[model samples]
Target chain A: MTTLPTPGAVRLGLVIDLDICVGCHACAVNCKEWNTGGNAGPLSDYQPYEAQPDGVWFNRVHSYEVGDGPAGQTVHFPRSCLHCDNAECVTVCPTGASLKRAEDGIVLINEDVCIGCKLCSWACPYGAREFDEDVGVMRKCTLCVDRIYDEARPEAERVPACVSTCPASARHFGDLGDPASDVSRMVADREGMALMPELGYRPTNRYLPPRAKGSGCSAHAKSPALEPVMPEGTGFLGWLDRLLSA
Target chain B: MHPALSVILFTVASGIGYGMLMLLALFLPLAAGPADRLFGAVSLGLALACIGGGLLSSTAHLGRPERAWRAFTQWRSSWLSREGVLAVLSLVAIALLTLAWPILAAPVECIEMTAAIAGLLSAATVAATAMIYRSLKPIARWHNRWTVPCYLTIALASGGLWLDWAGAATGVDFLPRAVAPILVLLAAVVKALYWRHTDGLKSATTIGTATGLGALGQVRPLDPPHTAANYIMKEMGFRIARKHAAKLRRIAGGLGVLAPLLLVIAGGMVPALDRSAVLLAAPVATIGVLVERWLFFAEAQHVAMLYYKADAV
Candidate 1:
């Protein structure tokens, strides 16, 4: 049951645009809010009001400063389950609790059967799985399966909570299996990259690189100032006539 | 890579248990009459207790210990499941051999055949356990060719010491006096080689490679997504200081290998001190192996930490 489906299946995944992401953390927050009430609910937080608070979160955003000084850029990377084609997490599950959907290729864990040995988490290179200590089960991003397929919700809004809630429009959700899909086209156009392709996970999600900064432009480039117009006369009518002529 | 106590205990105890069981199975044909029956009973009892206790202790670390039985289901894909199955099969074989030993006295061939099967199964069970860690490609320290042999050698060495102690206690020189010491030396050499190999090795992935940003200059973490520690940080980002690690390695080496080697050699040379020497070596060697196991988990580096700007995996 843990065996993966054939490659090039309907791999529903996300494509994030790093150039526009401001690291607002709205996606992470919305993920927590929606998933806590959805399939994997109540992502229990320990010591909520205490000095050290810990909890399970399906998605996390990591900000890294790449390069140095002039060429440096702060990259905010939001990491979640990539729903990999060759997911080791699923294969390493001793119980058949972890499964990859042959239909959509979304990986999921059966909480009822999961013994919570933490092997799946260790097997994953991306740190996609989250152990829910309270429920004594492993939790991960389901790609909002409930919302995405629910007929009750509006068709336009049928996307992952993280993708829909992103204020900066940094996240895109579509079938990555299709080469001609919108997300795939975006990836082709922008040269989207896998997070750790060297690891050979074949992650479905792709990240668009930030646009190269022009040599003349600075981090805080300002618009050029307009030349000052000399007033022909001290009167308002004369100033208006000079401004109109200019 | 957090060296959980339950797991450390499970691996060490079960390894020794399985090793002892295998040795007993190999020598089952020699045990005969009332005294030998008592000896076999006691030896087999010890093996079962150690193996069963260790297996039970492993479940204690699980979040849903009650659902542990389901772990036996996925043997095709999971090493842990295969280990569970093999452990049960070996136990069953040993049990059958033990129960039928007295009744099957007429045919020596039957006993030998059963013992052979049981011994092989025991060895296979230990191998399955080793593969659980060895198969993990994400951890550079554990996923290596040396891991399997190192585990097998250590198990045999520990088992040999226990067998020596048991033989000395029971006044039966069933095995050669030199066997235990020689195995201990071999285990020590293999372990040293494994350490040397891992020490010079570099992680396959670098921080830049992890982020797919190797084309850019040095990449560093400006800010972590969260100010507080998360599950990945707690589970995989465990770090040990170099000084402490060095000290622990010395301690493990001295207790696990050197002291046992000296005691076993002294026992072999002096007839009078044989019993006491082996008795002392058993506990000392166990503690050493325990420390070694702890270092194994604590030293492993998970590749996931690369996202946090870890210099290496």
Candidate 2:
């Protein structure tokens, strides 16, 4: 009764470029805006203008300083559902609610069947699945399946909200199965890395490493060097320094 | 590991239950003549009660109790599935043994040997049950090979004691009181070995390793990502005191090992109170093991502990 994973019409996935990302969080904002209005709506913010704030976000950006000394700098990494090839989340669900699509390789959740046991959430190490307390079901990134396949939407704008609103064009979406696809070419040209490869989750999303910076491309180059100068007011320490130097 | 009470009760209660059944199955065949239907009936009844109690307790842990039957569908991949299957097999064997006792009474050689074989099968079921928890790779403490033997020891020790009491109450000397001493020694050694093994095991991942950087320098969290505790922290980052932990370990050692050993030794010296010593040691050992199992869940460190800033990832 066991069957191998069948080849689908489209293998939907994402490619995130670390080089051009500015960490402005516009993608996160747009994602919240679109998803809140669309199928997975109302991200449930605890309080908008309160002392303490907490809410569910589809995309979260992390800023880290890597390298050392002159070459050390900040890199912004955005994280979301990887939609792994060997998804433990799907298999761990006891209610048969979590499932992968045969047509496009996109993983989805059936809210009606979900018992909210949170086993699927625990199985996933990426912290992708979110529990909706109001509905008593698990929620996750659907890869915007409803919008992409909509015939009414324009061809150019037929992509995820995060990808469409990326101001720096750092996010790319396509089928990676074909070698000639833009995502495949990008991955081939620039060495793309999967997060937590050792875990063997086999995430669908791939991250392209930042391009190396050229000579004289440092951010802190404009700062002036310290120079010795005479003090306006004379102090005991100043007098001591003068006496010692002489 | 979250200390889901249902699972704890299931493992402990069922362990005692199935283990007692194994003891009954072992002794039934040894009668000088045909098996006593009355004695056989009592043994089978106690075994069913224990298994039934365990199954009932485990179901309470599920969020949706109605959907509990769905868990048995994934037997190919889950240890929980195998445990269920083995429990059923043990139940069926007990039923068969009970029914045949009245018809097959009398013959010392045949009865004793069949009972011994049944006892071994029951023990195998206990081991399989323990292996369910031991198989998880993410939890370093439970995944070790020692989990199965430790569980088996607890079951044998507890079940043997209960059998002694039942036999005494019914005015039948079915099994030896000497089983208490063996159980005590075995339980003591198993606990010691488990402690020794876990002490040498390394942390699953370091903070540096979690970040995908090979840096050797000390890394501390400058700021936690969120103010409220997430699900991961609540489940995996439970911290217990080192001093209290050491103290509890001593208590578990005394109850699980030392007390039972003393009682058995006393029974051996004063032959009059042999039954009493075994009966006393069994409850003491169960209480001790319950405490031990609680600590096992509480003290276990998960790889996700790296995210909570408890240590170097």
Candidate 3:
């Protein structure tokens, strides 16, 4: 049951644009909020108001400073389950609790059957699965399976909680299995890359690279021409007048 | 890579149990008179106790120990499941052989065949256990060609020590005292080679590759995602100081391999001290192997740590 389905079979995934992400963490926050009460609900938090607080979250945003000095740019990376084509997390589950959907390629864990041995988390190279200490089960990004397929919700707003709530509009969700799909085209056009492609998990999600520094119209863009300021009068009188006027 | 006590205990205890079971099977046909019965009973008892204790300890770490029976259903895909099935099979075979030994009287061809089958199954179970760790591609330290042989050798060496002790205590020379020493030395060399290989290993994936940002110059973590350590960090971010690891390796090698070797040789030289020497060697070798197992988990770096700015894993 843990064996993966054939590749390119309705691979619904996300394309995150790193160029537009503002490190706001809205996606991660919304993800926690929606999933805490959703299918994998009550993502437990321990010591909420104490000195050390720990909890299970399906999504997390990590910020990094890429490059150096003036050329450096802050890159906020949100990581979650990639819903890999060859998901080792699913294959390594001794109880067949971890499963990948052949229909939409959404990987999920059956909480009732999960022994919570934590092997899936270890097998996952992306650090996606979270262990719910309180429930004694493994939790992870379901790609909002409860929300995406819910007919009661408006069709336009039925994307993943993270993608729907991203204020910067940095996250896009669509069928990655189709080359012509919006998300897949976005990936192709933006040259989005798979995280840790060398490991060969064949992650469904893609990350669009940030634009080159000084290439776009921004406040930091240098002006080609400059005009020197001239005082109304020459010498000490002009300098004193300019200083007083400033 | 938390190196939980339950897992360390499980691997070590079960390895020793299975090793002893295999050796016992090989020696069962050579036994004569009541001594054969005594040796069979005692060896099988020790084997069963260790195996059963280890299996129980393994379940302790699971959230739902009661549901452990479900683990056996996935042997086709999971090594852990295969290990469970194999352990049960080996246990059944060994139990039958032990219980039927008295009724069977002297050595019979069928009994020998059964013992041989049980021994092979026990060895297979240990191999399955080793594969559980070795197949994990995410942990660079575990996924290697050396892991399987290292596990088998250690199991054989530890079991050999116990066998020697059991034989000496009963005044039954079932196997040569030299066998244990030879096995210990072989295990030592393999373990040393494994250590050297891991020490020189450069992680296949780097932080740059992990994030798919190698094109961006020198990506460094500006801030972690959470204020406090989360599951990923807690489970995979475990780090041990270099000096401490080196010291533990020395202790493991010296106590686990060298000490046992010396004791076994000493026991051979002095007939009177044979029993005490072999007895002392068992515990010493066990402690040494325990240290080795601890380091195995402590030093393993999971690939997931790359997200938290681990340069390589």
Which candidate gets the maximum lDDT versus the true structure?
Answer: 3
* 2 or 3, greater by lDDT: 3
lDDT of 2 by residue, A1-246 (tens): 011156465678889998888877888788878887888776666565676665666776655555666565566667678777767677656556777777777778776566666666656666677666555567788888777888899998888889999999999988876778899889889877765666666777788777777653454576576665756337898788778877
The number of the candidate with the highest TM-score is 3
State the lDDT of candidate 3 residue by residue for B1-313, as single tens digits.
Answer: 7888999999999999999878767776676633376666677788889899999999998988888898887787888888999999999998777766644544576677778888999999999999989989888889998899899999999899888777767766776657778888998999888988988998768888888877888888888998999998888877763349989998998899889888877877898887898889988999999999999998988888888965746
What's the lDDT for all of these models?
A: 0.84, 0.69, 0.86
Q: Cα deviation in Å at residue B11, candidate 1? A: 0.5
State residue A181's C-alpha deviation in candidate 1, in Å: 0.4
Model 2's DockQ?
A: 0.21
Question: lDDT, candidate 3, residue B128?
Answer: 94
On residues A156-178, what C-alpha lDDT tens digit does candidate 1 reach at each position?
99999999999999999999999
* Model 3 iRMS: 0.9
* Residue A79, model 1: Cα distance from true site in angstroms: 0.8
A73-115, model 3: which lDDT tens digit per residue?
8899999899898899988888989898888888999988999
lDDT of 1 at A240: 88
**If you assessed candidate 3 against the hidden native complex, which CAPRI class would it receive?**
medium
Best by the DockQ measure: 3
